[model samples]
Target: MTDPRQLAFAHRRSADQDRLQPAHHPVVIVGAGPVGLAAALGFAARGQASTVIDRKASLSDGNRAICWSKRTLEIMDRLGAAEALLDKGVTWRTGKVFLDDRLIYTFDLLPEAGHRMPAFVNLQQFLFEHYAIEAAKRTGLVDLRWQEDVTGIEPTTDGALLSITTPVGSYRILADWVIAADGARSTLRRLMGLGFEGRVFADQFLICDIHIKMDRPVERWFWFDPPFNRGRSALLHRQAGDVWRLDFQVGSEADRDAEVKPENVAKRVRAMLGEDIDFTFEWISLYRFQSRRLKRFRHGRVLFAGDAAHQMSPFGARGGNSGVQDADNLVWKLDLVLRDQAPERLLDSYDAERIPAADENLLNTTRSTDFIAPKSMASRILRDGVLALAASEPFARRLVNSGRLSVAATYDGSPLNTPDGFTAGDCPTTRPGAAALDAPLSDGWLLAALDRGFTSAWFCAEGISADALARMEAASARTTLPVKPLIVSDATACTRYGAASTPACFLFRPDGYIAARWRSIPPDAIAAALARATGR
Candidate 1:
């Protein structure tokens, strides 16, 4: 005989799922955060359908992230949302660090000819989410279902099944693939039994968005001292116009309940002003820095991006930037799989490449955090010494500012990224050893061959040969690059971007960066690069 208790428990479990005939799709993204939205837009960019589900009842109301890196801005530019963000956000080229009212370090992002974009852009996270949501809506490919709570996840041979409970009813969604960008406490990650391992900073921090009545230029200012609070630090960042993001170190020994109080937060901000800042506090919250990353970003059909994959301290503003990069790495593979352009082997590169980038950023962020908020006397002394050196030396300042770094995904051993005639140390730029990260990508394969007047942003050099003409024709039939085989005959233009003499070929990726450049364009290499970038 079956026990009534067991039967009831099973029924309750099924009821929690509240599914209605399991919906099916090519891909399902859990969470409508910036990363999930970026993934959705990626699907649209590749002409695929994705269903994004989020538990949030409404959009983010607070200032979560106010700093955007150059790479992220470029991505938004491609997605057709940068216009709105740029119009509202402030621009800053320099970041200054002050130790007890004395300038200790000043770093400038606008360097002399190295990168395609600057180190950072100051904007609120709400504006970021607002624009991403609007851009995703225009795509007409994403089915964003908010107020939908995921209760269970079940994987199948074809894909995985998601059981979600909405306010209206329950439903099941079958997805060819699933991405988890559901923040630190990700339900999808937990359901998959994935682990996030790292250290949580012992110090507590108070973050507040205040409308201070002051006339300060659009620049990021950081103060490291107890002048405002004993043994603590403060950061003031401009978000759009009057709204500013201010973070005050609440001390390790401070009571959490007292620190989170709005009155106490105002008191701290006022203290920083000495007399009175006369600021209206918008929102106040307490948080701590952590150095944690997931062991694996992928688990069969379920993939992780953004905070789901890892979480680092916001010292260098690495979290959202890394999350956007995660989307960039993933979207291409998903598009390829959807179009059947490449084998599933291509998807393997996502974890291999992105995990390393995440780990690298993790280390840099932790070091910066430790340097700023040292716990021990010895560590503090060492940090002060380094800060002093950075204040005086331009090289040291550049190194310190390099932590707010951005990069493109370069899968060294991935089958997609070929090992052609391009030598290992043959980097064409000065981007601090991470060549691919700093380099810009084109729409598709770029063949830079100087024939008479070889010219094209992506591909250059075409000759009188029938085969070369045929190769251009073949390229036109497959990729999205405007000039598949443009015939450039301008000598002056050839030397501008720094290319070899005539008859050289350079294949470009969809993001407009040179992927494979050689002495001459090989037919097979051209076809492979096109296939990799376009997924068709």
Candidate 2:
């Protein structure tokens, strides 16, 4: 068949313009992928306009990243694209693991009820990007310049100077800040001579997306040393549009080009299916696993995010999810600093917070990679033994590492969080520096009540002192900074949030991470916490 990538482009082409005119923008993003577009939307949500430049003429064609975690969906929701994505995506909460065609175990993600988003959604990366691109366009705050390639990046005294080459010609842009959301092969990272250090595994993995009519349940299926392929691992996941993604552990010795050929791909599919089954190949690619990251994400005014800041093996589905989180973490800080609501020093916290997150993702992916692709014969033997024991032993089942999947990375030691001083019998569902857990409220979930800035949640009894309420309201009205006060009246909400004790309060940052909590509503204490949260 015909290559889908060669078809007519869907995005608007860049029009010719005068090259000598230099442009200036508050923020210029050097990539239009999901992460970059989401970053633009993040800025747009905060009334910050950004220009998004991408080398590609349109969204990607293949199904690159298929799994989006709950936190990612929340970030998309904040950007106004989550509903659109959920409508077009396939939602799955169950997974099955097998050892050589023998069923080892089955697990369910157990998505919580009343939460605004599910645990995970399986959608093609291209389709998600399409949704993001359209959302960015609707905002009118994002200037998306397609076919614009960023060739050079120079850190300026104020921010950064970027050299962009488009179909018209090369042009220079001066911006107060620049975000490099470019993918793994980031042009800005390369031009800046940044080093991404890590390990490269020896095994090669082949990913194929096929359009076929299959009765397989909507769940993740992972096989170790399956009958179709001896001594190799395989993964099968269902995507929307009746497309299925299959991954095979093709050893390093296999030729990459030969493995992706239609005949070779057909041979592998035929092995999985019987001689009578029918399927059409949509896309195929070969990739080797790697865990690498930059030492720091912020270099002067140019901030790196997504695959540009960190790279990890795909075993955990952390690649895209973590990238989206990176965007989420940086945008709020960028907005704060740009709006002068927070000091420039506040930007350093982005590095401190997200670097650790990247490290955690790298560690998880590394463990999954080691488990899936044992380095030595002894290791492989141990792996097989564990798999064998997992079939019968309950304890061994916990040790099986088919792919840890993705979850929200907590900023345990984040400097932005105000430590909880007052204690209760139960732990607060949302801890300091942890992503706020969604809970059913009287009208909506807790996440929906949060603002884009600092939100102070006051859980009080039916009748509160008017003086105390006045103090809290006065603190909220102090500035134009993104700060809001929310009161929880229902007793169920108070109990569920572990704030049943009268006057319990929780402070959350714009990204939904809890910044601080108080057992009693103290006007002075809340003001101090907000001051520190905004880098006062």
Candidate 3:
């Protein structure tokens, strides 16, 4: 086995680069947003030539997203900058719900064992992007092009060709493939003629980012006042350095015609404070959240990611999290195809897996939003009742926490998935379509060897021979990914894991879903599974 990169180079004499350009880009990602940066990181780490271009000369305002899940932080760490970002962000252990001044229930994002950060943390979206871009820059594979926008696109049989315009002039960007992460008004998505379905809110809300100090006991809080006003005002969250993200529902009568008045928003917050709490303001704007999603994510040479694919209210942090997931799903497949290890059909799975997820997540986030709407009489009644019910009972608190927000996303019946069964490659172990349950997610590749209890190795056991392991080591010299083999020994453990019942190996995708699995390992079997899993 040769290093895929070297193998690709060697085969270059036999292969035509002209055909794959744009389609076979070293890698070209459009959008410097978090998802784009993350994709760039994944590509660079995988030994691909990557370029990231954005129409905006600078980064985002970073106002929209601020929450990071434990799993997300774990990924950032692997990319090598989680600590730097985590250190500056606020670690939220608990969030409390209140009906006006009455406290109801508090939810804690306790660490789920083997995790360094809490289940969730609140950081300014811009700040997180900064760390990611900086880390991505260090890989040196990231070619940041600000003010570089894709004005025209034409996918040829060979690859994707795009007319990218910069501050100076326009040039042709030929990529093996193109990643569309430019956001909700995605020009690429429109050009691909993909329809974004679902609905937007009829009522618009005022989004005000302010600096406020409260004498209120709660460090983080959600306030609802139903009888007083039927407008929903959410305390988006507390950000780093004590700044707060706040949203107040505006009256329908006042301002559909007029621009959102900053002073009026500030006055409303001051009025809501009731007391003379010291406060300084930062930023203010109007936002009407929509729950929109693309009917199709991939068409021919283009793939949609981030806001380009789905649109959701910033309710349960679904918008940002799901976008990252889009990146996660698309990056690996892109890596494989660019390396010439898989067929183009692998790209199709991106839509099949992610669109459904977007719909489900949109449902959950909106339901949570409705539950916490802060304005409706019914929601107010429900919030008050739940708070009082949860005050003295432990189970009730758990019910509330687990009921609305979820720690991770699970793929059900994905194109890359198979029925759950006990075999050499069952999910509870390191089998395909499975992520490690419980603590200490291995820093390297983890295989659930079911021989004695359970064991793991960085390498796969091909023929169960030392020579094979040595050969694997030799092969790895060229490839960058360490194929750690975790071999299990205990029969009881083996039987429990299903690998004992079936002798096979399974490889998981980056999102912890199984990419490929088999009763046995063969190039053809692996290739078939990879093709189906990737949807290329």
For model 2 the local lDDT of residue 365 reads 90
Q: Residue 326 deviation, candidate 1, in Å?
A: 0.9
Write the residue-wise lDDT of candidate 2 on 281-378 in tens digits.
Answer: 88899999999999999998989999999999988789999989999999988898887878998989989899999999999999898899999899
Model 3, 168-200: lDDT tens digits are: 555676676778888889988877667888876
lDDT of 3: 0.61
Task: Return model 3's CA RMSD, one decimal.
Answer: 8.7
**TM-score head-to-head 1 vs 2, winner:** 2
Q: On a 0 to 1 TM-score scale, where does candidate 3 land against the true structure?
A: 0.77
lDDT values for all models: 0.68, 0.84, 0.61
lDDT value, candidate 2, whole model: 0.84
Error of 1 at 237 (Å): 0.8
Off by over 4 Å in 2: 1-21, 422-429, 460-471, 474-482, 489-492, 500-503
Worst 10-residue lDDT window for candidate 1 reads 3-12
The lDDT leader among the candidates is: 2
